[model samples]
Target: MKSLTFLLVFVPLLSVCRSQSETGVDEELGDEEHVELFTTATTKLAAATSDFGYNLYRALASQDASSNVLLAPLSVSTVLTQLSMGASETAERQLYRALRYHTLQDPQLHNTLRDLLTSTGTTGKGLSTAARVYLSRRLRVKPEFLRLVEQQFGTAPKQLMGGAKDLKDINDWVSQGTGGKVQRFLTKPFPRNTGVNTVSAAHFKGKWENGFSQSNSLESFQIDGGTTVRVPMMHQDNYPVKMGVDSDLSCTIAQIQMQDSVSIFVFLPNDVSANLTTLEESLTAEFVQDLSMTLLPAEVSLMLPVLSFSSTNELQPLLADLGLSDWLTSPGLEKITAQPVKLGTVNHKVVMEMVAEGNRYASSTSPPSHLALRVDKPFLFLVRDESSGALLLVGRMVNPKNLRI
Candidate 1:
């Protein structure tokens, strides 16, 4: 897609468990004194998060192969990492393993996360991430936990009295974070005994270095073997694009240029007869990096269907399947406070819009040729931040006619 916009909303289901007794105290900030930036550990964490994201993608895609699936991999991973800061020994272990950061120590893992977030902002992309923990006024939250939240995640824990107005406040925060792309993330009223609530959101709209024209025309898109739909496909000819084929997955990969040190890579299968399962299963951070190296630049004619869709996914079941089970049931978060608590719900929602932009190149550099790459069927695409090598968004367009935007 030419212009891609993504919004990710992550809200942990926070309900209290008053029956259990827990006793613990805050550990001193001993890790901070010894914390140092570990580049190798950071690189490993990036690769691990990508692997975890792909695994989660396959699980989500298996639910409905014909339906579209869009996700912000970095956003979800960062949220889980933040939650780990207050987790006890066993719970933190499961979280680290699930996030693919089991090999990293506490200090190294957090420092790398801080650096990664910083690098993305400096790259000039329209990317933003915000996280907050909302606690009930009745509970006495530990000062150390609040301090770590501010020092590491850059946000303080906010106290909520619990009502419709408090829900509106949280939604307002989400709306402001996503630039109004997500107006109301929390759709239901808060439970009467709701003790803790955590929200994480990310928004991204990348700039194109060589832009596309605003003009668009209706084109035929193959939804499946016996289905065809007409969508407003955007066109740009004589643009230099890197194209290649992945024989293992029976798909062609095309790297499209964008401004602000990033690019959108498209995975179009050879034909509609092929499904995205094979390609989705084969995805990994290393595989994508290697595939990027194999692309050969060529003057190409492109036809990409305009895709804009919003989706919401509940992640509690998926998190359990990924081995982070404690947070859902018997969460041992003694560091946050002495109160016995468990995560209530972990819901993720997104609102995305992809639109045409300026026509920077007035004329084509090469003559119109017979060769072209038209994405007319089910295909997958990803927006990657080149500066820090982070995958910003992953999406699959199965039926272009059913755009939710």
Candidate 2:
């Protein structure tokens, strides 16, 4: 029952959240103590996902060694200086939450993912079969998630929607569950789709021990493709920090650990935005060798924004990309049943979202994750693993239920 309750909590964390043509809601990121606790939540959730995804996300979480080819904006010496002041806590909290949302456990999302291997017959051959088999292991982690999806087949059926909610029920769940952080990822109103749809969502709220000084005002920034935009970047004079480099090639990464274990890493491109590629490419397990160990001290400055995202994508591409091709087809999937189970192949779909409270971007290509994607225009976001650095889920959400598994 406790396990089921945990799965229930992720539903409201919509990965891609759509701006509802309005913004002024009373949102709070909680106090520092509460914020620290989220780090614990994020770490546990990330671990759970790693187990369910079977290290698929673990690969992405790894950050590679820093290379000369990718000169960083900040030096190891400077980063270490900041770390000594104790900033890693904040970064850890952020990383933990991001990983949690990236972990994918929505009912609608599960349906789409389940289909990749839900073969009607035992033609289990190739990657499809493998994926389904691997995913079946999640039955225990997502007992309720499965039942909820099964329920979508009917109402309070003698069965649960794979023991999870149906696509139809997602809207109501998101509206109130996430403090309204997630609303309409579902495109359709109340109509239920005959096809099974898996669902996933995420919500994040955090406050800075110190708010941005409105006086910091506007700043000019360079982005990828050599474009520049005027952005209202936040300014934090001497934020807490942590840093270290185990070896030369193994670049030092600084962090701000939130209460539990979640953390944040700011990748400052030497050329502002030119190194965005490095930031992305270096976000893998093999590359993460340096980060797994080593610690140092440093002084810091921070720019962050308030961000929210919710999205939907076919699970095929993501799974295949993650070395789980064997599970994308029939016979590759698993049947989660007990009694006169009428259930067969299981497909999976996912949605994830998060929010940050801070500021800026190095460039257009590497848009500053300002923690502030104000509701000026309907925007998009993703909850990706801070470890393997893989995108657990992505979606452009206007409707919280806009799923395509």
Top candidate (TM-score) = 1
Which digits, one per residue and each the tens of the lDDT, describe model 2 over residues 1-405?
000000001123322221222222324433223112113333333333333342322232223222111110111111111111121344323322322323434334323223321321012110001111112222322244344434432111122242224334555554453445455645543222222222333343332323444432445444445654454445554454554332212223444443212344433333432323333433432233234233344334554322232223233234334433432332111223231211122222222222234333222333333222121111122223343222232222222112222
Which run of 10 residues does model 2 get worst, by summed lDDT? 1-10
| Candidate 2 C-alpha error for residue 342, in Å | 14
Task: Please report, in order, the local distance difference test score of every candidate based on alpha carbons.
Answer: 0.70, 0.30
lDDT of 1 by residue, 1-405 (tens): 011111111123222211111211113322223322225665666667777777777778788888888877777787667667778998788777888777655466787877877776553576665556677777777888878868886777777767788879888987787777766678775566666666666666666666666335888898786788989887778766777665546677888877777778999998896878877877777667655555667656778887666777766577776766655687677787799876655656666655566338667555674558898888998877765567777878888786773
Off by over 4 Å in 1: 1-41, 136-138, 191-196
C-alpha TM-score for every candidate: 0.84, 0.44
Top model number, lDDT: 1
